[model samples]
Target: MSSSLAPGHPQVVVCKWSAELVRSMLDITPHVFVVLDEFDTAYMNPDWELLSRAERVYRISDFDSNEEISAVAADLILRRASIDHIVSFTEFSQFGAGYLEVLLGLTKDPMRHVAFRDKRLMKDRVRLAGVPTANWITLADPSREDDVAAVRETLSFPIVVKPVAGSGAIGTVKVETPDDLLPTLRGIEPDPHLKSDQLTAEEFIPGREYHVDALWSGDTPLYLIVSAYYRPRMSVLDTEPGADADATPPDGSYVVNAEDAPALYSRVTDLHRKVNRALGITGGATHLEVFERPDGELVFSEIATRMAGAWIGAVISECLGYEIHEAIARGVVTGKIPEVRPSRPYLGGLHLRPKGPGRITAIPDEEEMLAVDGVLRAQRLRSAGDSVDHAHPSEWCAFVVLGADTREEYEALARRVCDELRIEVEPAG
Candidate 1:
């Protein structure tokens, strides 16, 4: 960690939706440059007034290649406003930012960024490093019939399929049988953010799933929290036939005590360290998901080189008594990791989705939701006229935050909140 080129401010290049996050970083040091996406201009342009408060803004579309991005970054460096760090807390911006970082001499290796972006490459590296992961094969052209045949011939039933480069569980699916395989494969629409046309067909590991969120200083994990989802993320996509994607499915997640499940904790943390090392991730926040088989074997799910989305950062802050974003900002800017750890015993967060697709007619009152015992925060992400897409968890309409002294207490509070909360929607016509 070197000091910022400027007297006190470190110039950082951030990508996509991370502009808002830079506000907290400004408190630690000034000079945040955001790279925007052109497609987002239609909705984000109006918000630019507030975002422009940063030192500078660049658009990804403006640069045709990584070389161009590096060229512009080099010009900035020559002007004595050298970028101290190039970072993106979102999957969309990681690869490009990493390339720019290497070009600007910010990162020691470039493959670290590549591993973060390409799932197939990542799995290869993890396997080579001797970390346990599901058996997987890549589909270069998913639309091709032969590729679908390859998946059927090789992988077992209930195989997990997802884009080689995707986030937020957007195009992920579980093929339970041969009949469901081709349709599920064909139904995966292209994502603009995913640069690769390849798809992954991996053996589905059945077991309890958990995610570990941690901030690292090189190979050392400075802080860690393990969370278990009430239901696996992919299950949210398994809706009833004719159901709308916006319809909310049943889902909840809560932080778990490491002491209560020491064996599980040890296995997860050990793998987390291995994955970080395999990917060459030396710093920044990481979000990794793993599975615990019924037989008690641990298997890797996936890893991201960014903070967990779905408001997990907020939940972590609420439980730990520190803002993860602030710690990450300070770490990247000054190369100093915080000493803070989780202060609370147990905390949980739940999302309530519309029962079916339609216009949202009504929602539970905020005051009523907050009144629930152990409920810390209640927010309605959708309004009366807003349409709900039930296909994915990302379309869920409302969320509740909860805290309790014990896991039993947290589960009780979450169940009560779900049972009491009401969200009415008219079936889509």
Candidate 2:
């Protein structure tokens, strides 16, 4: 009999929810049954339902309260079941970890999986263990303007303001001056539903950024892939000429959500490994963002205890010939080490930005762009007549993936891909 698919069905939730993740898990367990506990963020609607029909199915909904969520998690344990493994990959998984312990019947220490939502606390503990980190402070009272002022005085200009306990860069802002502080505060004010832990402010380090995709095997590091950040398309930045002058600077905080470059990836691999050990993060799949200063020092921006978002999973696989998400899922399920060998020496990927702002009126040269040598795949996220904001990566319109034999070959293909593809957005006015 297949595992149950209902909420709190312990055995059914072992498989990952996303298409890419599911495909990877199937490589290990072809007939896997996945109990999707929370469907809102992890999986979309009709697609999820269709997949559930063929595979072992179970569904779960958000509980009315935190207590309910905890209760449901606990009850699943009392009903003894043979769940080969228990796994969680979402932010809410932190809350479920304790409950999963009782349900999984595992003897590992659960407390070691400390809740890492708090930037101040997470960095503090890591730093005390001799990890290199940026100077940061938490403002318990974001309502008090003076506290914001105090942070500015201490961190100086170009400081990053964000919720101390948060992810996705929702209320994150880079304040460049005393005048910019109030405007930045006003911007995040609408996020009133934000948690108190979402109130940390820190100094902004000017450096080139990179991401390390790794796994932890019994406190030993197993790096699956390392990404070189050649370009960063923060949502707050302008997509074109006039958009920059009109919109407020640092309006959005999602880093690498919109666009990235594939050229700088190799140089970053060693740098990330060094910092990962220093930070005392020796397990699980971590998406570590780092900043390489002009002076050659690598500084940390932040690290998420999950995979890098925004098609990065696919990007990593295409560029480096490694399946990172698959490694993470396998490790979570059986506590087994993943075997990953990069198949190619050189590759590249690129996301096209709107040459200018407006509605996406047309993509002029599709076949010509696709015909470019080394271009492996192209996906256009926006369709004709789709309205696009100048501020987000989704609004950027399209992406291209390529495999190459040399760094020069990969870079040349990327430039040609960007140059040949054309995007036209209708002006908002």
lDDT of 2 by residue, 106-182 (tens): 53544434434457766676566555567887777776878877777777677777776555555566778878877
Model 2 spans > 4 angstroms off: 1-12, 23-58, 63-68, 82-86, 90-115, 165-168, 189-197, 232-282, 319-325, 334-343, 363-371, 392-396
Best by TM-score: 1
lDDT of 1 by residue, 1-429 (tens): 343356756677766654446776766666877777675564554356656677766665632367658766766666667776766787666777778777778778777778887788899999899999999899888878898888899988879888888887777778899889887776877776566668888999998888899878777776778988767888754543221343222676788887787887787888888888888888888899889899988888888988887757778878567777777787767667556565557887777776677888988766877888777777877778888867665776777778888777766666667667868889876
Off by over 4 Å in 1: 1-10, 17-20, 38-55, 59-68, 192-195, 237-249, 335-343, 365-368
* Model 2 quality (TM-score): 0.74
TM-score, cand. 1 vs. native: 0.87
User: What lDDT is obtained when candidate 1 is compared to the true structure?
Assistant: 0.75
How close to the true structure is residue 191 of candidate 1, measured as C-alpha lDDT?
Answer: 70
Candidate 2 residue 245 Cα shift, in angstroms, is 20
> Root-mean-square deviation of each candidate, in angstroms?
4.3, 6.5
